[model samples]
Target: MTKRWHSLQNDRPFRPITLLPVTIAFSSGILMGFAPAPLNFFPLAWVALAPLWVLLFTPSKAKAQGEKNESKRPFFLFSFSFGISFVWGVGYHGLALSWITGLHPLTWLGVPWLASVAIVLFCWGFITVWGAVLVALWAWLMHRLESVGVKGKGEDDAALLSVHASTPWHHLEPLLRSLRRVLLGTALWCGLEWLWSLGPLDWTALAYTQSPGNLAVLHFGQISGATGVTAAIVAVNGLLAEAWMNGQQLAVSRQRSAVSSQQLKTQNSKLKTIALLVSATILFIAVHLLGAVLWLQPIAPSNTTALKVGIIQGNVPTRIKLGSDGIRRAMEGYTNGYLALAAQGVDAVLTPEGALPFLWNEPNKLRSPLYQAVLEKGAVLWLGTFTAQKGGIARSLLTITPNGATTSRYDKIKLVPLGEYIPFQAALGGIINLLSPITENGQPGAFHQQFDTPFGRAIASICYDSAFPEVFRTQAAAGGQFILTASNLDPYSEVLMAQHQAQDIMRAIETDRWAVRATNTGYSSIVDPHGHIEWRSQPRTYQTHAATIFRRETQTLYVRWGDWLTPSLLVLGAITVLFQRRSLRS
Candidate 1:
């Protein structure tokens, strides 16, 4: 028998999987991530994770059919992850951030054509690769948790441990068993996202994918912050994944049974149908219930103050934003927008990041026009510009008071990895001109920047700083009543505009602050405390509007406590992984 089996194994060619699941995994990861971007068909995010369910079953299916589950080599699992990452990277990060290539005359100037393209692609590649690794890590954790859930006893000590291994759970009904996956998957995914959602590599959270479009879903930001919303979205995806896996396993069990094919009528179908129905219903209740608790219509505290401010969009072209001509043109456009808003009776006007490009030797030279505008209108002016510091340049938000005094300046704290401040410039500077010596690099500033405005205590943010919730939370904790952010979206396409708008909306919801965003290209908007988009500008359009923004002294639970969900998730995931590993080994 051994000889026969050996001969049979040699005779049959190996096939761990066919092309279908492989295609499914790649397509699902990319599509799920892409749904959050330009097209924003948010519903797809729920099922987008279903393809990864294949990974969970592939090994078990192979085992049940008496095929090798897969090669035991350590690298095989990692290589599988590499494939997952490549496709995901191509579809989501690559497409979402392709605007990096539009860095234009500067990128194109300092290098050969191919090198410039490479420079643009470096970030997308680095992030995609990092994301791929994280996806693989999530898969590993999922498997570990699965083992813990279904296998309480050692695989070797199989003394009829349960009625059956194939059921949704050995001891619980299908609904309860499937709910376990929702918990496990949500925890594991949140753990990984928490690890990455900081500093330079911090580009996304599952919550942002559903933003503005799903206002009810977004209110989760108020309680658990973005991580909570992310957990909820991932949980729905995970339950669906479990349903797919459980259904496939059930079919495999039926196929392998010795009874006649027609004897068993797929007894678990009703159970599975109910489980799915229950899971979907729970998610629906969750979103709306949380929305009601954290709705934008929170009764205004007696201290709530309303400030009408002007939001201006310059719509400057990418090439000119940094050039001398571009600088003058951006200022002229901003001046006109400021005047227009001033005429409309706004108390203050906010301009997008780099609305006034600072000249090399004269750091405050651009302040003249802003000072003049503030003095003439007798209204506050918040404008974005770059200031020359000792080492390099710092992106700053200057608050020009009505008395012609540029009183408050907040330099941007978080800098972009490649675009704003190249990593390891010291080592790479000597090698192949990596420093971009002529280019203005940024210096990190204070963690929180807040000022007293005519309306209330206002906080300021530069373009990318708003991506990190802690930045806004810190300011909110420091008594900031309203949030003001400035951004220049000229180099990128409309995809970034939407992606960025979603992030600012989340900040507004998280901190319960009325957020007003000013953009050089587009997507300037006022986001209410409940995360609703009160008013937003179109992409690449030169427009300005005054919206009544109420400043709230009340802070939300998330803003007060900071991100409690992520740490709790990390702890829960660690215990599960350790317990499962021990159980499996024993």
Candidate 2:
């Protein structure tokens, strides 16, 4: 163990220059963990590129002497370190919170570590491959800038010769050269993001990092689904790298000129360095301004129905959720809450998942008086419950119309792996303890479904279903102008859990639909069509707020096409990588 630790330590280089890249990468990852809840921002996103810049710019003395290929190893090491530290900090922390909530502590510890390793390896691999491509592109730009011939008469010829001694290649002007690299890099990053969206890890976009604070930048998301924000983040990182490189080159030139013999060489290097910095600053400012304008735009609500909605937050403890007596108590609590909301002149009342507590098919089930009361009050009750179906067991959102009619039912598409249904349960058998005994194991819904309400056509998503974007998008495409997400987050999640869960806000923005999230414990929020939170209940609290939300008939680019831009971008990014490799070979 001691020897293994020593080997691992030795593999990780502790150079001062490497710290910048690691810090930037790790900080960016940590920021992603806090997104879409309450504390979201893009300013700190600048730090995300620190590690990559350091790795690309910092020269290795060993590689310089041609003694060893230190470049390849350092890139991998830097990427791994950055990915591990950042993902572990951000992603694993939530798993720790799960452990404290009494989930098999061993499962929490094991699962989180495994997930962290998988995520870190995947992200690091992406950075390593892409970072190398960027480096080659930068080198090509440098070469082109050096090739730019003389421009201004005899003085231009003299300047060209002097510049060539230090920088070389006079064919490519400095501004044009920088612009080419920036454009290419931005295009590549955007493309990669688009392609990756088709995969299971589609949530890894830079926009997810800002989810916790997306409300502030809601307008920007309407045009682009977090991809636009990612472009800004990458652009900022590139600019920082350009600035740092310039400063380093200038300092080096000054030192060389002080030696007297290399004054001309030093002067030329300084000029090139200044030119690069100026070009980089201009590009950075332009992108920043563009992002600012998009972010500052107002997102107007599209629907004008003005439906009075009520949310029931039954804070039932996990231990009592499935027990016979516990089921009675859970039913009583939800029914009473619904009745109270009905009295408040609410058009519809919402409840968290499994609010019924008991299995819907259970014989001689207690019919609560709240159902009759809802009918009498002329209010629609949207209740999250469980029902037995041909698919085994399904968690469903049942709509009870004002006339006591069981009007519409939408089943949950995405089921929680362990909490709802055990994975590989047939092979594992009794090794896994089920969270509920409603059925042998709860099954996933056939597909996403939308229901026409008095307010408008609305789509329903259960707790775990909100995590998947494609599900919500399908519902929106099927004419769901409004979305209702019912979740019971009390048993396994924390207040901070809402931060991670806010990824649903992106769905609202992506689809241009108003989203109402009613969680069992807390985080009941009204997310407007543009993904902005109009109102939210306090976490871990039993509170209800009646806020009016407007639904939009207009579809966003993402909603209309669904990750089409991302896939195209991915192809273009791949082509850029190929071009970069070819350029490097030349």
Candidate 3:
């Protein structure tokens, strides 16, 4: 059986018609998608990528079989790797981002039902393809590096094809090469994630997969934001992939080798595998140990006092919330909820984004009964309101005191593309009109804006703003005490809310600050500095949740350095690859 398997592998190239690679890649992606909410089967994240890695790191069958079509081999392998990667990406992102379809039934925007469906699908497919393209690029580059000897050769290629295995240093070289490969592959993955997060669509990071589970590993976020956790994940997956590939390659080498040298090769292979396994195990343990240290680190107390805050969920539907009658209903709901919560002796009351559904400086807002109620109850309110900006209106979070004065206002900086504004408006503005009501794109706020509340200085994030860690990190670095994120998730499902909560949890751990989230229609939550969801309100409910969240001023390593680990590793990998190629040529 072993002889037959080895002969089969050595004689023929990998056949795509068999569908093994495609199936494994697609299944792995689907399995990995469950690592985050709402499924949250996070253990899948560790092993799901192993199959893909095995396929990626295995010696290209074309080269192994001495194919005559040398010109077509590179493009064939590149295209094959990219196709498999895109399939995997499709499965993973398609499952993870299925909630995007909740934006359907866009008749509210006067868009035809067919056009609305097309728009939503376009958004979903576009994002999924974008994410998959990144993964494909990473795989292609990783494969290119492997083939060029930057990451070294497979066990069969080194031990069977090459004469270097006869050298005295063969044993040590195999282990060293495996170590370098894992490090380089992991670093490149981390770098890809880091660069992706800087773009407009930054959702669905690998780190968030552990956000819902694996609290121990999730603690690493404090070291380098989400990228730290991503590095750890990719490292483990790469190690597993390497181990699997080595075993397969070793099996093939044993089958084809001469009887006398077989024993020596077998023993040496065992030693190399054992060494690599031991090294991998130690590396994994060290990651968790550092995470434990950071997780258990005590956050120092702040001079500012804790604030008893109230979060109001109005449960208003997206369509109705904009209508005249819906406006009255929402106004009444927020007004009543605020008064009730303030009457309960809460220090301040919070509302979801667009609670008032009107311009901040408009007469409708200035004449709000809530202003009088704030004075009557001596309460401070953080109202998510719209404000006039230079180009258009800004989604803003405003702090209103008992005196009806707007003390501090934080305009949301990260506006949702297409949802808030059209991308490349110069070219596509005339063609895209799904969101016809929004004739002009919403203007984003300045990045350096300060957020001050009656309780203390706070980091204000409005809805989509929470997805970007740099936003919160910048505020935290500037001495912002606590995080306050207000979101309006009326039409979307609880999946989005849960995912948003996960985002806030990671932000909390990264910055070592308490996070308070206020959302319309569900998932109003308060997360502690330790990434614990202390209190979470029910979904699709009109209610008020009050909790005492402390103001924290402690700056974590991630907060101070801001995602430095991955980029550093990436640079190291580049330098190593450059030098290795130089040495090989000389």
Please state the error at residue 527 of candidate 2 in Å: 2.9
| lDDT to native, each model | 0.68, 0.57, 0.79
**Per-residue lDDT for 230-296 in model 3, tens only?**
8777778887777766676677667665776666666666677776677667877887898778778
The order of the candidates by lDDT, greatest first, is 3, 1, 2
Tens-digit lDDT string for candidate 2 (1-586) = 3233223323334433344344554455455334433445445555555334433332323212221222335343343333334333343133212222323222322345554455445434543344333333433332222223111111122233444434445433333333344445565566655554443233345565666553444344555556665665665566566555545544544644366545655565456556656655675566556545654546664346566788877776655676777677777777777777777887888888888775564242336666667666777888788888884788888888887766788888777544576667788646654322223577777675677676678878887666566687777777886788888776445533465356777777667777788887777888875456678776666666665666656776666676554455446545544554444334
Which candidate model has the greater TM-score, 2 or 3? 3
Error (Å) of candidate 2 at residue 161 is 13
Query: Tens-digit lDDT track for model 1 on 1-586?
Result: 3233223223111443345445766777667766675677877777777666544433332232222222333454543433443454455555555556665435435566666566656656776666666666676555445554433332111111233445444334444445555666778778777777754677666777787677777777878788888887777776666666556545545555566432332455446645775776688677768776667465463434767789888888766676878777877888778888889998888988878776423335535565566678887888787777778788888777777666778888888765677567787645525434335466878775676665667777888887788888888888998899998877777778888888888888788888899988888888877777788888888898898877788878887898898778767656655654554454
Q: Which candidate is the best by lDDT?
A: 3
Q: Can you tell me which runs of candidate 1 are displaced by over 4 Å?
A: 1-18, 58-82, 104-114, 144-170, 173-182, 255-273, 296-304, 359-363, 432-438, 577-586
- The TM-score of predicted model 1 comes to 0.84
| lDDT minimum window of 10 residues, candidate 3 | 63-72
What TM-score does prediction 3 earn?
Answer: 0.92
Residue 255 of candidate 1: its Cα lDDT? 57
Runs off by more than 4 Å, candidate 2: 1-42, 56-205, 212-216, 257-304, 362-370, 425-440, 446-448, 492-494, 530-532, 580-586
